[model samples]
Target: MYARISSDVEGSGLEVTRQLEDCRKLANSLGWSVAEEYVDNDMSAYSGKRRPAYERMLADLRDGERDAVIVYHVDRLTRRPIELEQFLEALDAAKVRQVRFVVGDTDLSTGDGLMVVRILAAMAANESATKSRRVKRKMEQNAAASLPHGGYVRAFSYAEDKVTVIESEAVVIRQFAERFLAGESLRSLAAWLEDNEVATVAGKPWRTTTLRAVLASGRIAGLREHQGVIVGPAVWPAIISEEQHRRIRALMQQKAVSGRRAPRRYALSGLLRCGKCGHPLYSAARQTTRRYVCVSGPDHGGCGRLTVVAAPVEELIAKAVLYRLDTSELADALAGRTAQDEALAEVTEQLAGDRAQLEELATAYADRAITMRANG
Candidate 1:
């Protein structure tokens, strides 16, 4: 007998045990020996979740381990019409002459029985769809009211109410934003969080993927998102400023673009820009020689192809970096800072700050307070 319930059936008083008892009684009356039973507890068949017991039972029937299948009801077996068709096919292939039910004795081996089963399955599927639509409508209404999702937000960074930020986690969130915007790599940040004994909302150590998700989230910036798209501003206070969020997004996009390009096989892939076409030069190795090539041809973008040996380019870059580290005053201050802070500074230097910074710089340049020669 196959008996399944999608929830705490005993607590809900669904009587799965009673269903099994009835099936056994029915088997006794028919003069058939009761075989093994299949049960799936707290598993929704209509939700399309895997029902291991149901699958195993089907396999057993196909392998001739069982000649007959019994269930409490047809809906208990399946709510999907497509699955009902599959079962019919499997039953025919297995040549199972009988399908018994506790509540009803239907000879399922006939064409008329199959049609009746299909119609029952269709009705079950319709009921499931109607339930799903109602649930979705309720959720939509809740979202429109800016209510906490699913009646409980339970986010790490936010209070149970969802609108109020938890100060401790909120502080960590701001630090995450600042560190990321400053240029700390996701993997490095994840490792640092682990080293500092910072646990995720689930009380697990941080991962690069998880850290990236947090950084990418607009919820920290007081924005509401539905299905991955930002719907509007959220009711909660933003942990990070809008400028910080914008800078983080831009940085993420830049990283994504670089990631989409070929993996850097050599060290000097990003240090050079094409003098001729202004495209970033990439490292390409040919036999023993690693060369930096500006691939901005007609095939790539459009540019005058520029190529240079990697050895000299790398040497120049190394010397410049070493010189800055050894001689620059800023480098001395960086040495005093944490690895995370140093990394952030590097990113800030690359990005030259946010849009407001650029606008301010432009204004200063126009006012002659910052000369183009000095700034460059």
Candidate 2:
């Protein structure tokens, strides 16, 4: 039995320890010999790579070091169908039984096994996609509606953009912008808000994350939030001008890039050097393919280099990945490291603890055992 949990799933009663404990108890009563354990902590399930512990366990399974595999649930293993296919082939070849708390047992040889796995993976994928879509849609809607969706903040509230006497959080909004422009850090602003007992729309204490959202909020710039969307020219007045808003946005964008949250289309964006000159390569559109090009500009004495097609490089990468996604019986495949916690194991443990009490009541009800009546 092996257990794994991401950092997010730890310490809230979903720790990996709970999974192993239940599996260990079950293995003992079932006369099954426990083999080895693997633990992967603080790993992300969306990464599409193998955890070191998981990879080692898979290798052990192939090497005949383990006969049966137990997890709190199947999701603890993988949420990728292609990866599941690779593993199913290996387990089937070894005649290994994969037991999970929710489903009890899985036979990899049957179509039902793969179907069940596909469903779990699909559910996980759907959940992830839905979240991303929700956020994007919220931003777009906010922009179109001329409302402040409070970008980057979770359920943020507002009074008004700017005001003196009537219905406005303008005082706080202006303070946020001024502090940002004065080079006061977002963390420092969060502390200030907390010290002053400022609360978000949800009536929660201020946080660095919330402060960052406030500084980036277009609300002060006369934006409004409607249905998880942002719109402009709100019913409220502008606390800050568009130019000032841009400046704040630029600062936050810089911070996001520094924090590594910026979108990167290619992993090798800045690292790929020119084949001829030693200059950093830049991408260019060439028909259906992208080409890396380097030209010696005015500063470099106008020495030019010819562009090379990216087809060969891209083809090489695709081939390598396709080869890795192989399945048994010569079937084709394609595949992450993801974090999944086994909630079902806790259910199993709870059921076990109740089993004895339930059994006694069952016997009493069946009339096989007499229940002694206690006088009040």
Candidate 3:
């Protein structure tokens, strides 16, 4: 007996149970002794997903372990025409052609019955395709309306409704954004989240990839994204400002282009260049002694003619840095940096005002309060 239900949304397995009962009754009435039953609940035949029980039944049929097959319906046996053909081939190889269906009373013993099964399978496949198209269209419409996509778990900083911001998680999200923008590495931020007992929506420990995704998502900036494109503002309130989100994205792109590396083991790892070729010297070790050497190869593109003892060079650079920090020129540079910081703050505020004005113009145009030309 082979019983399968395409979808068991409630996961009750009642449909599969009902199918097996009907199939068993049909087999008993036909006076056919059943050796075993194959059941595939919550599995779809048209989706091309693996159905373990169905495959086992086919294996048994081909091995001649089963002389006959019984199912609740033809569609239950298979919705795909190709799979129906494979089933027939399996029966032919075993030289056992007895097959029965409780609902459609389909029999593989006759040529007409085979044709009917093929037609039913084709119809089922068409119906599945239509349903898939309808569902995808609905989802696209929902995305255009800035509605939340369906998911089992809520978004990181949002509630189950997907619109309401969870204050606690939102706070953490802001902290993540701020720290990341301040030049903290994703790995460091992930460790901070783990150390602070902050778990993801799925109750899993923080990872760099997961942290990077949340930081880069437009959802936190009150934007609706569909198929990896930001369509418009989302229904939910923004966690951090759009400006911060844009900066995070830009920084992430820059990091991706340049490629990030693990923390430097030595202070002067990449700071010193070769005197001969001016190429960056890589840190290397010989026995217990560490040194910086210019490597020659397609990979390094260096002259490989210069080498420096790591200890002396590192110590000299450290002393120089410390001495330079106490100089009047350094004091003057610090003062200049303070002024630059203030100027940057003013520019940032002005940019925010401009962004707000642009948003108002967009809103006016959308609401038909102003013409597109006037909004522009």
Pick by lDDT: which candidate is best? Answer: 3
lDDT of 1 by residue, 1-376 (tens): 8887763111113357766876777677778886888988744545678888889988988998998888765767875766777887788899988797653245676544554455444444444434444467789999899886765426768877888888998888888788887778877777677778888777777766567667777888888877566788989999998788768877876666455433233444444678887766666777888898886422233264788887776666656654553554533332323224556445433422222232232232221211111111
Candidate 2 per-residue C-alpha lDDT over 231-314 given as tens digits, one digit per residue, 9 for 90 to 100: 556666677777887788777656554653312122122234666667645456566766756645321211357465665654
TM-score of each model, paired residue for residue = 0.35, 0.35, 0.35
For all candidates in order, the CA lDDT equals 0.62, 0.53, 0.67
Q: What is the lDDT of residue 100 in candidate 2?
A: 46
Off by over 4 Å in 2: 7-13, 102-105, 132-376
User: Which segments of model 1 are wrong by more than 4 Å?
Assistant: 7-13, 135-376
Query: How does candidate 1 score on lDDT?
Result: 0.62
Over 4 Å off in model 3, which ranges?
Answer: 8-14, 42-44, 135-376
For all candidates, the clash counts are 1, 23, 0
How many clashes in candidate 3? 0
- Could you tell me the lDDT of residue 360 within candidate 3? 33
**Which of candidates 1 and 3 is the stronger one according to lDDT?**
3
